[model samples]
Target chain A: MKRIVLLVAAVFAATMPAASAAGPVDITFLHAMPGPLGQALKQIVDGFNATQQEVRVRAEFAGNYDQLLQKTMAQLAAGQRPDLAQLEVSLVPRLAAGGHLLPLNPLLNMGNWQDFWPVFRRQATLASIGGTVWSIPFNNSDPVLYYNRSMFDEARIATPPATWDALLEAARGLTQPGRVTGLGLILSDIWILEGTIWSAGGEVLSDDGQHLLLDSPEALRAVDYWARAVREGTARVYPDIQSWQADFAAGRVAMGFGSIVSWRFLQPQIRFPLSVARMPYISRPAVPVGGANLAIFKDIAADQRQATWQFVEWLTEPAQQARWAGLTGYLPVRRSATTNPQYAPLLNLPATPSLKVGIDQLPFARPRPTAPGYVQVQVEMRNMLEQILLQGADPRGVVRQTVERANRILAEEATR
Target chain B: MRKARPVQDTLVLLVTAVFAAPLVWMVLTAVKSQADVYMGPLWPRSVHLENFRLAWETAPFGRYFLNSLVVASVTTASVLLTSILAAYAFARLRFAGRDWLFLLALGTLMVPGEVLLVPNFVTVKRLGWLDTYAALVVPFAASAFGIFVLRQTFRKLPVELEEAMFVDGASPWTVLWRLYVPVTLTSAAAAAIFVFLGAWNALVWPLVVTGSTAMRTVQVGLASLIYDQGYNLPVLMAAATLVALPVLLVYFAFQRLVVEAALQSGLKS
Candidate 1:
């Protein structure tokens, strides 16, 4: 028995170094993307691994954005952080403040950083941290108007709405009492709320990130418009994203606001001809840039960090961006990606026109508030919107209370 | 009492049916087409078995099942062994600070599992066990709840029986395995069921420790199905049905023993 044990131990010891030497450097990439987008991300990672000799990237499907944040924070506290993560843009400032993310500016040398659309570039910049670029934008998207063409035709609307007033008018025209609601708005997400505030010429946070600006008249006007719409039976707020998406796909809603990312998933399910339009503006066309960005954790080995940057840079390349945009419904972050020969066929497809509209709206896209307490603020905003839209609370009073609560939370966060 | 029998039977049937409705709905939804799902029909217009096949192909569920099986089985076996030993010492053996020590073990029941997530994760990482079966199985090997349950059952065993074994020159180990364990077999089985279910259904710890698909358990795999496939209710329901099958089978098989064990534990205590 002792001899056998000795032989087994010797064999195991001998195989250790051989295995280590033969294996590529393994790095973990945590992401929250699910479904077709997740599959597309896997393809990109597989492509990178096939061409590389040094680093093998493993794309892990961490739950959604909130779950990803929780897991990453837990891992960080445990000293077992992944080499790379895809974080929401609004979360970058908080994570960077925690000293959990590595600054990419020092490692980046190849890509034309300026090639990124101005909106994406601004969103990816961590102004609180010496204005350094901390993450590379990936799967970037903006809200657009997804209207059922058949419903629009039945309502005698010749064109999609171009302004908030026109949108309300079209919504009112499409209502069929108990049969179909005119519009479905997702009240749970802060992205749409921020976009509405911006379109109404109100900012969510001041330039210095010290105070709330939603108490302005423009912000109140936007909130009141949505509240009145809901109360007037022209629009209904769904409980969650899936509920609203299902309502639209089931022909229960005529028009809805959704991210461009919804196109790939919703296209197959909807039986009607779905048309996309730029988000209807109140004063000027402005939508907040939404989606995730690639962030490298600070604790990875230096060589692994270099390899991670290589993968990030490769993923953001014009050709790769075009491929990703084509596979997923996300907007390509690079200007040259739209003109790339490889993507020309994708751009000519019927489904690409809506994406074209999304692309055109990029110039007017705005970044979400980057306050460290912004996540909590988003919850407050959602609650306030729910109160106003669902409970018939006075819009102006709710807006004022919500802003005051947000400002207090920001103040507490500042001291921390 | 005889006249109340039919009423009791009817009430039982109604409650059982109520409890079973969601499971039946899940199975029905699993076979429904995506378009047929939202139509609010009780049954699919046409049975679409393709959702199950598509769900299986979407992720490596076979690997997830194997991972969950191995982790859960090893964890259950370890828990039984450790709990039996600890419970025997507490119930049968005379030792210094025995009561204090058992009290300490029971004290852990108050700490929520969620509060230990970060600390346990850190300890596992420090032991170089991240992404390994050791991370999933070892931290959970000795469940305090298992020890407490087994200890209660052990104390309820007739002390005269153990004394008879001792008088017959039987070793303590002999007394435990040969005499005490047999008498408390039902309780042990109940403890095993609880431990197995806990290990099988665990999500947060396994998700935190394991990053590779190769190490992910079925619960995590089922969750990932929802992230991308939330709109595809049929596929999601299919995946969920597949994940719940093994646990349901286990429960159905030992349900009589489980009920007897529960009644005995409560009555004896």
Candidate 2:
């Protein structure tokens, strides 16, 4: 028995190193990419795994952005949070304020920060939350106008609209009564509304992020344009955002406003010639940059956090970013990625015209409001817009009441 | 009255068709080509059977289905065992604080499962059960509704049955298995179906507990399909059809047990 035990101990000691060498540090990365975007993200993750031996990222699809947020919060409260997660840009304030995210300043200093676009860097910075950088930008996008070139040509229009007044003129000319609606407005999210408000020279919140500014004259003017368009039969608001995309793809709507990432899905479905253009402006060109960012949770172990940072660094490398942008329709977060030789072929695809328009508009892209209670504010804004466009509520009265309610919510959140 | 019978049958058929139309539409859409999906016709221009292949390839649905099956079956079997024992005690055994304990168990019904998500998650994490089959199956092993229904059914049985079993020198375990279980199979089957469906269709708890694709259930797998394949209605519908097929089959196979359970309970009253 003594001899057998000694032999077993020797065998166990001999094999331990082999086991440790083959087993990489395992890390979980929760994300909300769906469909083709999910596929593209998986390829990137798989690529990272194949290239490394020290870290293995287990990517879990945590539903859509809202669902991912809920899961992350619940897991954090339970003390079993993933090492890393993909968070929507708007969620930065709430997560950082709650102390759920790890500040990325130490990791960002390690040579990845300088390559990011200034816009993305600013979006990732949380000034109100002690100026700690909380996330790294990924899958960034801006809303652009998706128009049917055939419809424009049939209307005797030579070019897509460049301003709000021209948009109205184009809508009037493109409206075919029973045959085709001129514009299909998506009332589901606040991205388009933010762009409209910005174009009319209004801010969703005050500079300090403590007040609601939707009741301003600029915002009212923008909403009134939407209301008049809907009332005049030149525009229709779908019950859901996806229906607008579907109608646009089916040639039932002449123009639609959606994320530039939508090109990956919409390009193959449209039977007619599709044209992409900048979002029609009002006083000046302005659009809100929308996308998700990678946030590491604070509760993970040191080694796991290190592994996660390594994966994040690899993900943001110029070559990887170019490949990711080429596979997915999101604008490359790094400016240097566009000039990379590998991205040249991607830039020449048929979808490049629309992508170019989005890239050109990037200079004016502003981050969505990152106030603590901004999600509630978005909900109120959507409800107000829906009422004004669909129910014909007076734009001025609805905007005033909505802003008052939003301000009350923000104040309540502040006290908490 | 004879003429009214046809009209009544026609109305019932119409209602049934109305209830089944969405499922029919899903199957039809699942078989449609991408272009035909949006063409607004009930019938497809050409059937694209490849949608199922594409949907299956998109996610690890085979693993998800297997995980859901194991979780559902294990949970249902455990729920049945625990519920039967507890119900027998409540219905037949007389002990101190028996009624109070039963009431306490019943009180748990008032608290919604959603309210317990965080605390339960914490408990599971402390046990180091995250991303394990135990995390999926253990927390849901016993159900209050199952106990309540079985206890009600057991109480409705005559006391003479237990007396006879005792007089015959049978133990409590034997009495439960030989007498109570045989007579209450219908109610047990009903409880089993409820537990099975609950476990199979669960999304939030499984999604919360497991953080890897290998541990995901079919419900989570199907949800991921929506974000990735939301544009391709055919593939989305095909995946939905696959996820739902098991539950529909289970319900169809056990529906008679539910009907008989309702009838038996009614007759006892």
Candidate 3:
């Protein structure tokens, strides 16, 4: 029996590293960036570690937002909570509802909190979370128009369209009879849909976030605008992002909509002169802000909370944000980060594709609806898009039915 | 044997092509340049083999390969050990509720592995096995599928041989390992392949369990290449092709043995 105990002890000793001598307080950060993006994130964390001696931050890649959310929930269930978590904007509502988030209002100073882009500040303090800032914006982005310059020139258009109606007019002129498609329609991405509905002055959810407002006349107009373009053979819909991007790069389409960060991937393959602009609005300029935010969970060890907040504050600083944006192509959360010396290279990157437009569009951005039930409601939205765009169903009746079904799904979730 | 007809042959070829298309695309994309992947012809105008080099350098693929090889090999061996002993006890040993226990053991097969993920993670964490090889290998050290396959193979053997050996003053261990193992080698190989592949291609459980770069597997390395929003297609394809090569080689080397064992041994009771 003693021999068996010794053997088990030996195995454990061999597997686990020795406990470190007491020094700096260590806090774990769970983030959703992987690949080269993850490596860039590492630099920010390493930069913080180098600047201070009180706290040591260890960051780990938790896959994408969906995967990171799953791992976070599992960790929470296991009582193995990380000190900090970077969650997607749409998912923050769900986390806030879980009651595990430490409301960030108390830890933040007014000046630091106020320095974020106005759109991001609005996004951070969503109504669904009781108007308290549950998370601070981190790697921010906004979808914009990336177009072929030669196609617009050949069509005798001097400037890209500034509104949805104008875009249709431009598409009519730019689309060649049997050759070039005007727009690469992306209906499946709920972010683009959110921007379109908001631009048309329609709400996806009500003020209280208890009911669906997608059946409004304004939302129907947004859907109808795209339907008209597709029916005229000026627009083509691809099944997924990669296929659409491939076709766009191949010059099959005159213009496409993608997040500003995707420029890093798309620009490398474009063999023609390209242009970037804000997402054309219907009534007024509005876009859906993309990317994740950092939050301190309520379950963190009390002593570790201060250290974690310090890490968050440091990451959002202009210098750190500038360095991060320059390395990863994620938009800096702070408006001041754009003009920092570190950001100069990105602004002047040889043949740089509109570095200022992403920052300029920050004031007009809105996050996807922050209702906890909207995640489940997204499935119904996808079905609505498929029906209207591909099946040619009337947006009026389809929109109403989608709202009814989505409300039922949301109601079921609310009860659960 | 029935002679092949043109329609049937064409149908078979079409089905084979359907299965082979993605693999062919993976290899073609792995060799092509980034621009070629988007706009070039079906075949590359110029093969840029440097994509493989880029993929290899993107991560510490050497460490990843070693970790994966060790985990898969050790897990496969442990599973075979537990499965053989479990099968023999149920097939030959006389005990209370032996058949009932065997039925209950097979009952575990009805539960999907995903349902057990959280509970397994909690258990491993409590055991201080996180970020360790034991965490990767120990929970999967025994598989119900492995036991079922080996048990079925064992039951197919003539029971009279064991009985006769026992009467002649031979021990059960000698009869089992020395006699049964030699004849059922192909069946054992079949079980080993499934266990090996499962351990090799694992993603979520392994990703959650192990956090350190030193302990990561090759699948995690491939996943890391697919970053935010957009990934480089040729580079991703190159990494995927490298990750899949070992499994393809293993399957090819063991194909005839598993096929013969499945055919020559009566698969049905």
Candidate 4:
């Protein structure tokens, strides 16, 4: 079968006519949104194009965030930069380290910079990069607790757990032998783990941003809290995020932690009642933001730069963001968009799992660690958790080792 | 040996099941509704053929198919042409450092394609071919794999065959097109098939080079369904099944030739 791959000659004209330069200041945008999400983004871009005549934005889907970064860097190296790039937040620090990102502060003259969700602003900013925001938050989301409402009722629970201790207890009660595992733990993203650490009054990174504090007493406590549930047979670690969502939709797991955006993928498959609530905290209520950001290159034409900024600004405006949030379940980067008339329907959206809780928890939202090497470090943190929860390894020992490895990576990144 | 036949047959069935499981699963998922996808019976209790229609409607897949068809076809043709010429010269023609140059061409295969991705992309951009078919087809036009296969095939041919052609007043070009190429049909076909497949399945390079939807390919469209949220497994599976159909048909039709041609390349080497 592999041998016969595309053997015959294609008679159709292969050469696509290059985009003409005669349009209204044609500019390119590289993004990572896919499927309906890409459609939503395209719709918004189309609206912007329809309403304007000075500049035309051509948005391109460049695989995913990692792929987008590669394309952006390659194009930047060739001095053929895309007008805009949608980058994941952690990627901003590494890209800014390349010194090719146009620091957004100078281009963003609008007063709406402050109107963006503070979490998003902080998420897209790097103090080490001259305290400048390198990217603007676009498709931002924070983790929330997703649970089976039917199982909670069956367990005779009155409300979803509000604290870490209560969550563990609920997991213990919700467990029906040979039926439902209480919680399905996602071992991919460190945002949930970081949020948990913060809720335990511990920080994932130090104030100086020089080290990971995962080995700190509070952080270790947070790790142990989840690991304890796993050891008790009330929870199980899912190999990946998709599997966790699938299990929850299948009613195999009573509870799980996922982003506000997960509902769009899970709601169509769910058969039982579901509920979303604030991320349960060990000590206090806090959540870490996760999602992609929009950035621009440093060396675009002056007119193109202004035009690109105008498009970027238009994309993040309250009205467009509200529509984007409605079409796609991504949280709007701007606070004003949540209160926009279009966003009101989603807050009380008719579904077993509504994502309004993610917005409700925004006041306590914080940014994840965004060091140049943090992307690599996240793998270590996730691995450590997977070991503890899935393999019954001792949490304290794993935490110490993971923190040491993380700091070493950060040190190497700093020197580079 | 005769008594062990049943055990071997059982083993073969197990291996076949292992290989066929995913393909079977994909077909089932394509027909299953969203409700059945997450939790229902392994063999779907109900089938929805409209799932394919829904998957097709979700995005501009028809446009993607056209792009992929054009890109793959143009690329495969170019690769075969270039490889035949290069391989013929390397195999039959006398030149200084002949073996060394062939070795140098072959050494390119040793470097991971990913390592060359950035430099190649930069070069393509500088050449002002970005978003054109040339950017997609030209860079992959001359593959070391294709050259190696054809060269091996050409080298294995008795020298008297080419000498006999030249004795009959055939030019090197005629000897190549009329004599060498047809005589080496099996290996060349193998090389063409392999080259076409690479061009067809490519995602990252094509995604980076082309910017507009009109230039997008099926693989890119498939990749777009897979985002941070997760796959709509049924729709994604349906689209994948649709994408696999033409290739499956081609493979089944050329099954014996593909195997024979592949064997020819390996045996000559």
DockQ of all models, two decimals each: 0.30, 0.37, 0.43, 0.53
Q: Per-residue lDDT for B133-241 in model 1, tens only? A: 9999999999889899889888888898889989999999999999878888888888888899999999878888888888989988777666432357788899889
CAPRI verdict (incorrect, acceptable, medium, high) for model 1: acceptable
Q: Which candidate is the best by lDDT?
A: 2
TM-score of model 3 relative to the true fold? 0.91
> Fraction of reference contacts reproduced per prediction?
0.33, 0.39, 0.39, 0.75
Please state the Cα-based DockQ of model 2 relative to the true two-chain complex: 0.37
Ranking by DockQ: 4, 3, 2, 1
- Among these predicted structures, which one has the highest DockQ? 4
Error of 4 at B48 (Å): 1.9
Encode model 4's per-residue lDDT on A85-181: one tens digit a residue: 8888888888788787899885346677778777877776678778887988888888888888888888899998999999999999999868889
Q: Which stretches of candidate 2 lie above 4 Å from their native place?
A: A1-25, A106-115, A340-342, A346-353, B1-4, B158-175, B262-268
Screening candidate 2 with a backbone cut-off below 3 angstroms (N, C-alpha, C), the clashing residue pairs are A34-B227, A34-B228, A35-B227, A35-B228
Q: What is the lDDT of residue A251 in candidate 1?
A: 88
The iRMS of the candidates, in order, is 2.5, 2.5, 1.4, 1.3
For each candidate, what TM-score against the reference? 0.90, 0.91, 0.91, 0.91
Between prediction 2 and prediction 3, the one with superior DockQ is 3
Candidate 1 or 2, higher lDDT?
A: 2
Minimum summed lDDT over a 10-residue window in model 4 chain A is located at A9-18
Q: Compared with the true structure, what per-residue lDDT tens digits does model 2 show for residues B80-175?
A: 999999999999998999999999999988999888888888899899998899999999999899999999999998989789989999999999
Which pairs of residues collide in model 4?
none
lDDT for A175 (candidate 4): 91
